[model samples]
Target: MGVNTLYFGVDFGTTNSSVAVYDGHRAWALPLDPENDLPTSLPSLLYISRENEKIVGRAAADAFIARNVDREVKTKQVDLGVSVEAYVGAEPEKSEVFNPALVDPEVRHAVRARATIEVNAPGRLFQSLKSLLRQPAFKSTEVFGTPYQLEELVSYILSPIKKAVDGCAGHAVETVVFGRPVRFSDCDDENRIAEDRLRTAAKLAGFKNVAFFLEPVGACVEYAVSVEEKQCLMVVDIGGGTCDVCIMEFQGGSGPEQRLAESRILSVAGTPVAGDALDREIIRNRIFPLLGSKARYGPSNLPMPQYIYNQILDWQNIYKFNNEEMINWLLAAEAFSNCPEGLRALRCLIQKNYGYLVAREVEAAKKRLSEVESTHITVQRDDIQIDDILVREEFSHIIEYTLGEMRECILEAEQNAGIRPSDINLVLTTGGTCLVPAIRAMLEERYGAGKLRSRDSFTSVATGLAVVARYV
Candidate 1:
């Protein structure tokens, strides 16, 4: 019997991630866990608990909440008459305190505390993710993880995929294709080092063969397969971490020949500012204000609720920590410090799962408003009511901030190709965020509505990579 060749297409995104495999003829999107019909695509979240050295995924999401103190709980108990105290002295209150002498110590303490809690979280998270891969749905010869750098944490996530694929395929699978952004924020040396680490991790995960592909180029290959006619096309793959654009000449026949011409990458452009940032902004600006500040304890000034909210947001964006857990942690921190209003509100927020729920609603609303005229987001707890149906305008502002960079990339691509906008046949868009109307409109206006076309916004890149893996 001959060995069957299998190609795995991975879309390792910042917000959400997915993997698909092509077994010669057709491609199948693998489930993240056995419980769902769809391929396992969830937010790229990894939760670590310093206390237990445990990492968890969707399962940890609830644990985060349970561990997180409800902000609302602390707020409602305002009448309890607990001392409303600030950690730092009150002399510097009512003004922006940027003094390193005063700020450094507090910031150091918070950072150390957070770092300590997160230390063992990644490993535990990998373990939980590994458990997910062991499900019976994705049977393959061997499973592999695709990471930019082969850290144990990355291997943790990848091993499950390898296992699932290996079990499903019913053979000893080896060669795996991993995707990388066209550009990396790290230097060339660092990037190479990262790739080496990733390769090592895959080997440790038990994979025998591993290859790399530029994410956007991989997406182009996926798009080229189904393309019947050859034309000059620009592929824009806007993912969670970076925005990658590729200009390729697709020569079509039985199979398309993709000649990569010019590519542009924006390192700073990402969904961190788009999806997660909006969630945190709402929490800090809207939800936390309702909780009030700590002012009565020991006359020391304390970090503002908004400041803490930003920290929480940053944490969620970077580590994929459980939101409920994060909120509860915040609440517990406040309670331990005896901040009356904050502790009370924190308790309520935890009890009602307000922070996590509101974050989800905000994300949903943003996604909805992107496609439609308006959308409503309802964040309900017993006493807290946050029902703000966002219209296109509000969503537009949020999108515009990100689109500014996209527009620049478009111009750069045009310049690099040395062709005017009219010479381009189509501006093909991919990535989850390309679903936004504002982004679509901006591209249409710039490249001419006739020249603009959006491929499968969600799966185009992954699909493209599948084809690339088969041929490349």
Candidate 2:
């Protein structure tokens, strides 16, 4: 028999990236390692630093000598070689402060040379690079001395994931499929820019031939293979950064013709509000109060700078708070603010770069709410921590607007596809956000619970794309 070589599918998700390949007879998802500790999907995150250290998530941190557990407790804050309390067993000893000022060669050199172990390690971490692509004004972001284009930053996220996939494939693979949403998150409503950035990133990340699949359509392929009857199905994909819907004409299970299922895609729609938006709802409404959003300053009792609270709400802009201008501004306000402790807390979050860390916990809590009536999450590092309970009713109220947008997207797609909610033969919901009780209730209420089906939240798109890769 000729050596079997199979095509690959890559889902470059906003919250996590996943890779899968068709190995002739079946599609297989590529995993990271011997231990399943790390999700087979890599976190869609990148951490840059002046100090040389291997950066991995909490799962892989233990295997390395100079490792920093993202959520590990720090007994004391580590700074540039002075007046710091002891951190009994904190790994990495310290975290290097990465700032935009590093763009100055002299300052960059000085920090690299003189900063302590902690001050010289993991400089700054960036998240949500995928969602920012649609912003026409967001041409580039400065990371140290270089101004990295959106595509370049995307490559930073894609590069390592490719390395893991390539290792599993055991060869230098070039051709691949990429999945994207029906609409990108942009006020300008420009999806072309978002796509071009993705293409450029894939090229930079080591792919020569590329194919694109609408995420929801790709998700439908997974359900298409499970039944022996042809069906008109709607795929509901609510991921970290976007919610996408697709009406697809699916082939019956068990035939070569099913590989050509892409031809049956009817209509697609999407909105850029899902898990990340939901997380922000919690962070802004629940967490910001603890940070100073409610605090006033000066004789006029003016509201504390709204901008400071806004920056840390999204991990993508969290680094913006670490600059001298913001820090100095906070310091000046602390002298006048009625709630200086709140301002101090804000400063601590920025200085330690805990935005992404806290977000991880918030996401966990959101997932917990879907399974139960209420749940609690804890965000902590050293002496600082925010422990709170999240009631589903409150969370649903906070995300009312997001749910509204998602409902409109589904209705629009159904209308465009010339189908009624009753017309869908099957309704397959996938993606992490799909698990939320509110999201579940919305869909079940529309189409009735009888027709609803579920797929793996993290891997469904990749699995579906792998099926699509079999033929085209």
Candidate 3:
């Protein structure tokens, strides 16, 4: 590599993103968003304004909350187009209907239908676009009447990171190595499609040369820097959108690039279950009842619709209730519900668009529970008020399904590697979700507690990717 040539590593994770650079001797994460509490990482979120201006990271989240949360929802009529329709009276002859020239000009007047659209939102907020890369059907979406392809949405997130990188390098660097999940989707074809989409996104972000690196393997590279002798290692990366496990044998002597090139990758596996799923489960199991998920409504006293509350699981889905049909349904349900207070709170949540706020509170509570035995969630917004205590045991139970999937993925990786848990010399855990007590206990039980090691949970992949970027 020429002294003038610079390579940067970008870990564009599902929940957060970071950029790093490696000098010949060392790799370190750059301060992408120093104002942020987590200076090295930025939340992977984007907001597109009505004027088509884009904002990302913490600012994007703050813009969404300040502009949307607790704001009154209003509707407007938008003219799609004009249609010409010919009408014939019930007593009109068939010739009049069949022959347009014979029809009266009065009957041929233009008919226009105006579509009712929800308005008043300052902008549209997009999150977790990385998770949708593997989905073939999620091609594009319109924001404020302008259509944006999936890659374009991702590019917005990358653009800011690249700008920061260029600022640090004192030049516009076009070459980068990005970390990707071992498998974006269950199918190999879908994984390839996801990578291609990511590559396109990087190109749109102004990169000329983009390379992909496995997320788990990147974590492994960081861990390998400390190892001097040969060791069989299993690296588990549980981030916001996916969990990836890689089993490899590493002998560290040379630099990160040479060490990785000489290492043996035994097997790898991944599943789309991680911190985000755990957050949703907390919303579903702990917070739903408070929002009247089980309340009864109508003359027959039927139970409230589970589908309505399920929308709270995803912040984007909460906006669906901004329309007339859903608003009417919520109003009618609140009027007739046995738990009127809960339904009213639910109305406030949807009408005021507080789903993101609620999600953030729940996610914070989840993180707190990881460190403490119990945590309290207090969200007081207009008619909506919630005070709940989440115990660690209950939190563990809430995420059992997700944890079980992770366990299954690990077992699959071990089987593919033709090795048992005991055969592994060390279990390296990285990513945010690895901090959960249950996850740590699970690893300790499967592989001896003494054999488990952890690198920096959040920035290891970015640092390792920087190391790889040096060679790529």
Candidate 4:
């Protein structure tokens, strides 16, 4: 009997990650947990507490809020070696720098504290998720965390889908067609390094063979699968992390019978300043003010335990928050003082009371801004109140700074491919962030609206990846 062929596609996003599988004719997203019908897309976060030697996910995100730690931290911050600080609401009257070694002690204490807390309990959190991923519905033995190598996180995110497919097929799946951005980081060497890292991660994650498809190109393939006839179409993919554009010539009939005449990834643009960056900017620019004196300490002058900053950095991931818990923690900020010593105490208090709320406001704003023209983001305290509606303009301004580079990238790609903008046949868009209006407008202005095309803004790459897996 011929072995059943099952293909899995993974979109390991920066903010959220997901997996999908294709069984010859149809593509379906795989559930990470049984409760949700949608494919599994978890925040790319993992909380590790040495005291209990424990790790947690969505629930630990909640614990982060109750403790009043900042939750706007990004994976790139670790890459940049930026250190974050935490502020407390008490006073020591003198600046005292605690030893870095104290991080272990502080984390241990925090973990122990969480274990006792009912809502923020790590054990329960861990068990809940463990049960969810291991449910018979997915037929998976393990759910992995973000990979240790920053580059490998994407591949690790993809592994579960591969596992599910292999299990369903009852055989090892050897090859995959993956997605790539047309342009990555400014530094070609860095961008190349990132790609190499991803390739390595895929191999380590259990794929024996792999091929890369530009994200926009993949969207065209999926779109072409449904449409017919000769036409020049453009595909735009706005995703969580990157925005991509491709133009292609589509020919032939509907169903599985279609032909791609010519294709080029016009621009693969990303703002290191994506949704996560915007969230952090909101925390740093808006939400932090609500912490009053405790949040005022400058990174340079503040004298406090290094662990406090470590905690703040840890709390920055929005995936760490648990609803109003983050807001409540910030409400306690009135008790904090502005002096370095006072800030240390306030930081400690926040770490104990409201870390996760700060994380959530930032996260919510990011999600809101994507679909809505404006969003009201606020953090309330007796003495400190932050209430502001972040409008589309503000987001557009931030986005433009990055999109400018993308435009330049398109010019370069055009130059490299030796094709004029007019010569482009179709434009393809993909990625989650591509849904942002400002981004779409910018592409339309440059490439013309008639040339552009897009798949479901979020899942096209994974869908194309499934197609690639089938061919491999």
Candidate 5:
């Protein structure tokens, strides 16, 4: 079959990405990370080596683990330059007459401070680039002394998926439909900017015909295929970075295009709090205390600064603490603290870039909690050893506020659809977060356990997008 005969859908999500193909009748998700032993979806990750070599997906994680973990960082100090300041002559005194003509001025100059950086570090690993799309201030970031635009970084993730899709199709496929959230940001303009950025990245990745579809709507479309009769359906897609809710009407007869044209879509709403936020809660509530969050230093025995521990709450932001200033502060704190073991471990974590390891453990614990009543989160490497038992009840309590927000999001979608909770005939939940027991319980409490239906948690959106691509 030629490329023109097929339709493609790319779910470029904040946490994981997947590509699906449809040839008018059949739709399936292509394996991007076959060796993962999990879902076919690819983890959204990028690694840039010291030599500027870029790697993506599973290989990226493997490369980071092989290079950064359990390695002692080597640092160096190098002079950057000197800064010179010019001012009026001291003789002018308080009178300080304005310069009607040229006058002698005093000049002060000092050597710029030297910066400490890891000279033998392997590379930098990045995740959650999709979350930065809506921020106007974040245009580019430096990687190995080279500046890379946001679109360029995004393209790094998309290009490989494009190549994989082409290999599967036996020819290059440039046309694609990508799934997007209902809102990348609270502001409409910012959301548009995020879409534009994503479009630009798709083009950079060699997509010739690109289209966008709401993620929740895509999930709804996938669920609609099995509907035997007309019914009110609500789709709740809670992914890594955002929670998207859609209320719609589903009937058996209509095709994807007709569904879009008709009043099938009643309402769509989304919030930025989702899986990652819950993971952060685990790190903050369960792991942070063991990592020196409660340590005290100085003669007065004051508690450690909250900001130091805050940096590690979000694994993606933990790299910011690797700078010279933060390192110096950590060293000072470690020397004076009543308990130096945790602070020392914290320093080791930053110096060796072990944040990814901690994130992986937390995510694994979260997954286990969904299936079991209790699990243990263990983060161990060199001097760092944190083992904590996390129970389902405690996990729910840790994420109580986040769960409340998600419930509100569902209510928002229902209210916008002009219907009460009872009006919904069926509930379709997708994405990794929906597998959480607390989240499932909340949905069951609202709509009854019998009404909740779950398709493929990871690939439904991509499949739905493929269906949309075929018809629309």
Candidate 6:
């Protein structure tokens, strides 16, 4: 069995990425992480942690060791599940516990693969490789003394997924169709730059021939599968980093030519305000105050610099809080605030690189709130303890601005599509945010309850891209 298909469709997203393949008879998603038995869609997350003895992707291990590894090593257990566990003994040991020098090359590469992504927990964790593609200020970042360009970093993230694709297809896949948002971030130039970067990454990831498709349009293909009649539809994709809306016309059927010839791409619009923004909002509103972000400074008794609190909102930038200048600034603010307890809270949170941990808690809470009226935001670190209550109403209010912006984006897509809401036959919504009750209600309110529909929120794009891969 050689490469079974001509092309694969890859939806390389901000929070999670996914890949789908098309055979002559059908289209289906391929699981990118066989090691963890992840679903068809892969978390668009890449983490690098050298200090941690365990190396697993997404939910495996933290994929990193906090800088306290030297100290924590005495407590952190080697993953007994792996053969390497015997190398470190049955119990937790000292700092040099599972040195890579003594391990097999496969284990060493697994531990050291993609260290240049984002989060660095006390210096062990990193993630969110897709977001950096749009940052003009980010040219290169170094990891463990190795300098990496954004493409190389993203490519590294894609490497494993490519391997999975090859193994599943029985032959190496060289041509691919990549699903991308119509807009990346907020600007046209940035979107173009990001697409270019994605192209490079796809190439670097092992696809020799690559193509691009708008994310929602790809989802349109997914939705059209069930319908037999031609229809006009709107697709709203709420992803980790951006919200993209598209209006398209589809001729629903399995014939590749009929599928390709009839689909018309109409309005495409997007905004940077999406799930990550909501995650940040949760961090700011519910988690910050508990971390002494709102406390007054000492002598002057003035409010601490707001950036000190705001900077840690994104786990992407959490490591920035540990720089020397930021430390000095915090120290001065601590002295001026005169509140030793509050200042200490801030210092301890920053010193331990608690942002990622807190953000993770906030995220888990946010998801819980979506399903229930309220949830708990637990922050338990060395000395910083916070078990705060967060209600869905409060979360709704916190993310009101984001909701409003998403509303505006939807309307913009409608306006640009040159059709009234009534003219649209169906409103297809997907992505993690699509599950949000408030978001669902908002769509239902505007599109009429009967006109709105839902696809597999997380895997729709990849599935559709798989179908379109054959044609595009």
> What are the clash counts of all predictions, listed in order?
59, 5, 0, 56, 0, 10
Report lDDT per candidate.
0.53, 0.71, 0.81, 0.50, 0.81, 0.70
Q: Which tens-of-lDDT digit does each residue in 193-288 have in candidate 2? A: 888889989999898777898888778876676566777889999988999999988666566455354347789888888888999999999888
TM-score of each: 0.68, 0.82, 0.88, 0.63, 0.88, 0.83
Cα error of candidate 2 at position 412, Å = 0.9
Give the residue spans of candidate 3 off by over 4 A: 3-5, 72-118, 254-258
Candidate 6 weakest ten by summed lDDT:
110-119
Candidate with more favorable, higher TM-score: 2 or 3: 3
lDDT for 330 in candidate 3 is 53
lDDT of 3 by residue, 1-472 (tens): 5665556789999989998887757778888766578988988999998888888888999888887676655767655332221211211232133333443344223223334445788788888889989999989988878999999999999987899889878988888899999878888888899999999999999988989999898888777865677889999999999999999998766566566667898999999889999999999987888888988754345577676666567888787677644554555555557998888788778777788888999999999988899999989988888999999999998789889999999999999999988899999999999999999999999998999888788899988888777754
TM-score of candidate 4 versus the correct structure, residues matched by position: 0.63
Off by over 4 Å in 6: 1-6, 35-38, 50-56, 59-61, 65-124, 252-256, 323-339
Candidate 6 lDDT over residue span 246-303, tens digit each: 8988876666567667788888998876888888888787767766677774222445
User: What TM-score does structure 6 among the candidates reach?
Assistant: 0.83
Rank the candidate models, highest TM-score first.
3, 5, 6, 2, 1, 4
The alpha-carbon deviation from the true structure for residue 131 of candidate 2, after best TM-score superposition, in angstroms, is: 1.1
Model 2: weakest 10-residue lDDT segment is 82-91
Winner on TM-score (4 vs 6): 6
Using lDDT as the yardstick, the better of models 5 and 6 is 5
**Collision count of model 3:** 0
Model 5 score (lDDT) = 0.81
Off by over 4 Å in 1: 1-3, 34-37, 40-43, 46-86, 90-150, 184-201, 256-306, 315-355, 382-384
Model 5 CA lDDT for position 62: 92
lDDT of 1 by residue, 1-472 (tens): 2346667776655555566788666776677744322346544555444443333245445555555424222322211111122222222333344333544434334422211122222122221122122223322221122222225555555656677667766876687777665554324554555456556667776677878777767666666566666667777776544567777666566633333222222121211123343444445544555554442222233454444445444333223333334433443345434455554554444444355555666667767776789877675565455566667776677456557866776676667777777766777887766666777788788778787767765555555666567767
Q: Which stretches of candidate 2 lie above 4 Å from their native place?
A: 1-3, 33-38, 52-121, 186-189, 251-254, 258-263, 323-325, 380-385
Q: What C-alpha lDDT does candidate 1 achieve relative to the native structure?
A: 0.53
Give the lDDT of residue 388 in candidate 6.
88
Candidate 2 vs 4: which has more TM-score: 2
